[model samples]
Target chain A: MLAGLARQGVELPSACQAGACHTCLLRAESGDPGEDGRRGLKPTLAASGYFLACQARPVTDLRAAVAGPDVITPARVERRWWLGPRVLAVRVRPRQPVEFRPGQHVTLHRGNGIIRVYSIANRPGQARRDGLEFHVRVYPGGQMSEWLAGAAPGTGVGLGVPAGHCFYLPGQPAAPLLLAGTGTGIAPLLAIAADARAAGHRGPVTLLHGAAEPARLYLGEHTPPGLAGAGIRWRACVQSRGEDIAEAAADELAAQPDPAAARAYLCGGRGSVTRTKRALFLGGMSLASINADEFAPAAAS
Target chain B: MVMTSDPRPLYDRLGGKPAVDAATEIFYRKVLADPVLSPYFDGVDMERQVAKQAAFLTMALGGPNHYTGKDLRAAHAHLPGIGDEHVDMVIGHLAQTLRELGVAEPDIKAAGAVATSVRDEVLGR
Candidate 1:
């Protein structure tokens, strides 16, 4: 549905287009989203006419649009910081407060319609009321990366509403949690850990973040507040010369304690996520219990 | 005989790759733990087997048939003691996995029917 709409010049911003991330869920004003489309959705949400566009084949002609699709909140870049040689941090304050869960993602559509999906690094509820933050890996000629690397404060950008499935829900509040990420993938993980702590979760959270070198372990510089205070254990894995992210992730998975009841969230490149999910499953973790968000490069529609 | 519009493929109605992948992993675990079926997978590379099974099930369920692995009869030819009983147990475990995942009864029966349709080839009969 999204692709067809895109072909007709109505571009929809999407990432992890496999329906793993709810990046393209839209409201079907008057149609039935087929059976598979209703899987994993709450009965209430199903009744509310929400459908994942990637999987929805409408049984009837439908009026579909992103939730409040007409509203494109404009945000201005307020700050930029380099987390590593190639990774940059961007902070933007929306014209209005954008409500989103800590681990959700937002798509930024440039004037030319180049839409890029970025994971929001700010925790919801109590992070900052004024703005959104993201960690971006600068690709030399990448349009969004180039613009983001040096976009001055006050430069305007459009922020799409946030959507994702990997956010921290207060499930089994004390459920053992496992989080793993690589490079900028740690952005969402950082927020999730904060949210867990803010929610006063008493479970053990084992966070394993990997970078190619010590310097690239961006979030390791200063432990975010409450990470240690809330008893969340964090480890940084580095491969100074060449980062074998999957290997580092497997090493992390190997050390998880009693993973049976743990709800795990893994983020990183698709290859790493796939390998890690496989390893975790073979290591006695249920595949259903492991939620993953693979940071696939947002493709041009 | 006339053909009608292609009916909704079973794979889509039951959920696509993600759903099938989840079911395969859980089902494979059960198959490996079953005393009768566990022996058949003793020295097999389970990771690859799990993926192949998922692809097979996806194709069998009327999704894009990307399974290019061994034909069922050829694949099971050399296994010791492979028979209808083993096939039944494997399919039973799969049905149970989908059940555990909260798949609706109709879809579960549809999936079981797909497995039954393949009995001859899987059992090399």
Candidate 2:
């Protein structure tokens, strides 16, 4: 029966068939046990009727549902560029339109079968065409970076859309907005700002961008020139300079009125994002109003 | 001298910093020409990112620990939400890059496994 399923081209999630990885563990709604102990469900998970389809043969008819979305489509590599020696602006677009909150990311498939994830840099409505965009910084010898450097136009890449929980929730439009980004992570904040502007939001939008040096900043050209005129004020901080970008952003936030009623979004290198979020929270901004996304380096393969 | 079956050091397998740097440069060029991802990188600085990536890789691949940089998660915390699909695409590009560099098949697979391990962390899952 497993052969039949495979012959019919039924794909299932699986890793480490010995059940060590648990990638194929699935909940069985209703089914009777088959004789083969090879049926990969652990005793504890099996008591709850969780079984591995890879190990379980379909006998006496079975019913099951996947925990997550069944179909995994590759994201398209829409563009790429070097923001600095280590920062890569890898813009990705999915084949389908994915709906997500302001701060979130998707997983991308390098041609070599490695998976690297990046945050969505554009908002739902800001794509101007189709699919969302993601900005990625390539760490040397990193899987995604290597593939991107050598890929040509019209390459097929895999992508899992709209993952991650951090995002801006809609609330009273009058709340002040505090936005921050470091390196390629700035992509999402820019998207949110653009979305807010397109929606004609009148709230004050302050964007604080930081980098190790002025040369490392990405997406400066794509930043809408009218952002300031649209009531969105942006300030850039070079952290290698005497004053760090987070410090400048905090100072700018302090000068604003009623900061307690503001919503803060911070993105960038892990340290910068953490520092900025802590500063905002200590400055009286409610914890619930602050959203953060961390851009971790892809571990060595 | 006979080549040993034991794995070569990552630096040797990657052909040193210069080879990695070349690969990085090629990756950005591909990204810029792509129809879907191009708009995001328009007007971005490519030279600086290439240099930083070389340094980061040198450390990651066990050559030298010269990467004095910010943590990854904090840097991307402010981005628009990324989904599973986007992650797959990024991974695909990475795999292609290894192939371009003439990396051994086993090494490529090992590299891919490493990238896959961190999917949840990078995607904020």
Candidate 3:
């Protein structure tokens, strides 16, 4: 809600400030209740006239509420394994069931205040059978990846609520679903296919996970049990060094016969997402039918 | 003046929606009268064009960031031979509209500064 305000110069100090922090919390003593201002706030606090300024979009005049810390849950590492040379697959079990949709990202915080965000890779079926799976690549000198490298099974961790909108939607079961991405972007695509299959989508779901070389393709030989008999088809493409990932994916998407009948999702680097969206649009897909999530480079901490 | 809005944004201080409506109306009138800028809107729907300009101004003045129009470069890419003279004529019309609306001197200068910042992009340089 404050997104529009921020665009108009009414600056609100926010980080992941995702209503998890007191940064945007405000009171609505009187006036139009903000649209979902009470979302992350406690019921008692939300009921007695509290709301988050970041979440609250007041259609009418309103009083601001004071802020508080977001509720966080504890998670314990169940197990982990390396998918290939570069990608590490780590599964963590929260103490209790965590409500989240496939394709949403969660914020993980270490004990000493080191915070990192990662996408949850487990589909609903995988979540039930295993736990939350995360696909993390070890970037040189990356603190979060370093910590995960040494983290032991049963180690304690904290997770913020799941957030982001690049997930599969039910009720569109028959629409052709196109999921394409590079590198760790395969995590959300895996989860999306799992959820779509679980939701009984009979339509063709095509997933193209790309990398610079054949060895970097992590899920190449291993197909998920959930998608084995389901109607989901997965493919991996290896681009020569410096070959654009989106260009490679767009070539595949443009070959499809009916672009208008497909809902295409493209993820990964900003350049790839933007180029693929443009390519898809040029290939006859409506802009509204395209959904994209860009993993922009994080700023130097 | 009867103030019916909740709080004043920068757009409101510049006389709100009605002022934007009027400014676009007058600014285009000035533009269409000039030979340098007239051809750009020759066959365009004036009503639609006015709405787009108002939305652009609203965004530039710290109002709702709801402008859905193309970025300035993309919007002007089709025009041929657009140069400093065409830009001056367009900016002159906007400055005239702001002056006519009695939008304070500083605000008008600020608005002009904002417009000038996009000169290269608008010129597609």
Q: Which one wins on lDDT?
A: 1
**Which digits, one per residue and each the tens of the lDDT, describe model 3 over residues A93-120?**
8777777789877766665545566788
DockQ of 2: 0.01
**Per-residue accuracy of model 1 over B1-125 as CA lDDT, tens digit each:** 11123367756766678877876777877876688886676545445687778876786567887443347778877888687788788778877887787666666677788777878777667
What TM-score does candidate 2 get on C-alpha atoms?
0.53
Q: Once model 3 is optimally superposed onto the true structure by TM-score, how far is the C-alpha of residue A273 displaced, in angstroms?
A: 1.5
Q: Could you arrange the candidates by TM-score from highest to lowest?
A: 1, 3, 2
Q: What does chain B score (TM) in every candidate?
A: 0.82, 0.69, 0.80
| DockQ of predicted candidate 3 | 0.03
DockQ of 1: 0.07
- Give per-residue CA lDDT, model 2, range A147-183, as digits (tens): 6866665577766544454566566577788888888
- Quote fnat for model 2: 0.00
Order of all candidates by lDDT, from best down to worst? 1, 3, 2
TM-score of every candidate relative to the true structure: 0.66, 0.53, 0.60
| Cα lDDT for residue A223, candidate 1 | 56
* Deviating ranges (above 4 Å) for candidate 1: A2-14, A20-53, A58-69, A213-215, A221-228, A239-257, B1-27, B30-125
Error of model 1, residue A179, in angstroms: 0.5
Q: Give every collision pair in model 1.
A: none
- In terms of docking quality, model 2 is incorrect
| Local distance difference test scores for all models | 0.73, 0.60, 0.69
Location of the lowest summed lDDT over 10 successive residues in candidate 1 chain A:
A243-252
Model 2 misses residue A5 by how many Å?
A: 27
Across B1-125, the per-residue lDDT of candidate 2 in tens digits comes to: 11125476565566666766666555544544455654544333333544654554454344554443234454334557656666566556656766676665666566566556656665665
